[model samples]
Target: MNYTLHQLQIFLKITQLKSITKASEELHLTQPAVSIQLKKFQDQFPIPLTEVTGRKLYITDFGKEIAKAAERIINEVYAINYKTMAFQGEITGLLKIAVVSTGKYVMPYFLAEFMKRNEGVELAMEVTNKARVVRSLELNEVDFALVSVLPKKLKINTVPLMPNSLFLVGSEKLEFAKNATRKKIFENLPLIYREQGSATRNAMERFITKNKLSIRKKIELMSNEAVKQAVVSGLGFSIMPLIGIKNELKNEDLHITPIKGLPIHTTWNLVWLKSKKLSPAAAAYLEFVKTNKKDLITKSFDWVKHYDKERMLVKK
Candidate 1:
């Protein structure tokens, strides 16, 4: 029973991404190529490594044990490579990361600064939904993730990056006043919503349920951008994170109204699996984020203010 390092890497990536297509894209291989590698690895083990449940890929119990061993092997390999490179005085490697879609706007700025300081390092970033980001972190597919919602049962460390504000927004054509009271707003419009498993969707549901608001006739969309577009087309109103609607608010394409006594705050976090080993590059990047996160938070809030003067208006 023999398996190649490449096969292990592919299996690890598949487990991390939970999709052959995504793992292939990250590895720069075709789907067939990735499937072939994974098959070869599974053949080396007596037990099945993974199974497909509905549309999701799940690792078997035995596969989880194998993945643990594979992590140990890979960590040793990385340590050896890191020491060799250190001996040669070169600090270079790929830092693979996954970020939730809302983080897309702000993380790039911070990453650009980090790259400038560390010219030898390269980054491979995937902008994905919150569910995918959690799956990736749980499987050790990515070095780290930038997200707003943390999973409940995962033993992971999270560095608070910034505080996010969620708002209820509607199309300009909806005939709803921009300053309408929360009660009036709810009574007057149908809700537009993000699909199940979205952080925004979860937050919206909790808020609405807590306030005893009826959400029976809502149009659900899969992405924040899609939800925003639906609102622009007058499909319905939605609760969205401020990051997603900054440009629309700036251009007056969307109107926002606050819900009095609504709790809509969430903290963006830099998260990684608690027991996973970090490469030197990943560690350095984390340290960089920790040191400059205050500046990053302030800059993010600057955009928040530019889009919604009400945030500042209320502060006064």
Candidate 2:
């Protein structure tokens, strides 16, 4: 029933970093001290808070739930502190964010701008896969997530950031023959693909199935960068977000070809749980996305132009 603030802080840090040594370093405590506090807290509760996998520490499910509660409690305490500081005309706090991998390419620009305007706020950001990003948001493990796909079952609020188009691309040397038809292209080349459960992979699979096309060979990869590398090496072709491959495309390391009824388009969404309370910093970020997303997309990406052209042609 009774716990020290240090205990809760340590739990939250350990859960965030998933390492005792890292949590200890952040908290200015020794590793043993961090472990002792966690142990004391766990002894009081019915379930263990953390488990060790090899040399790495993992917060257990129960520990994660407890850590979520601790985060909310800490945030509320900080809010009170912020109000006290605000009375003296000061705003200061840490903002934690988890973003899916592709968002890393763009969100940092917006975040840098936000940080410049709000000098008192500190940011902690983690770039993770879409599934982990969504799970972290669902569990209140992160303040918000910049993600590409929104889970249908979660009660969450979403602000649309930009539309992302998936492109079928390959090295210039391996480009589809100029006269090759869509069916011929699919039948002729091996396909480099992101692993299952990836948003890109899901979109690509849906398009392939809908069109009833069987790729010549499928090579599964783990990262967008890896897929690009594979395509650049002429290992195979891949479907990837246009934003992810802009530099390569520009450098002529990769070339894109249009498939009949291709280029699956989806939106990048900023998500937060409906029931979750946002801190001042988090609220500012949400507002920033709402007001500046259009300009952000327009200035940073050319995919929007491609999509607009395609849509206009479809309308015609």
RMSD of each: 7.7, 7.5
Each model's TM-score, in the order given?
A: 0.68, 0.70
TM-score between candidate 2 and the true structure: 0.70
lDDT (Cα, tens digit) per residue for candidate 2, span 1-316: 8998778998899899998889899889999999899888888898888888888787789988999999999988877887776676654677788887777776786677777776667799988777878788888987888877788879998887777778778886676567777677778899887776677788888888887886888889888888889999998888888878777876889876766666777887778899989987788777877788777766777555764365322100
For all candidates, the clash counts are 0, 0
- What's the lDDT for candidate 1? 0.81
Off by over 4 Å in 1: 1-88, 177-181, 305-316
Q: Tens digit of lDDT per residue, candidate 1, span 1-316?
A: 7898888888988888889999999999999999999998998878999999898899999998888888889978876776676777866677989998778876786788888876567688998788988888888899998888888878998888777778777776887665655666676688987777678888998888877776537788888788889888888888888877777887888977556644388888888888978887788898999899888767656767554445422200
lDDT (Cα, 0-100) at 314 in candidate 1: 21
Off by over 4 Å in 2: 1-90, 302-316
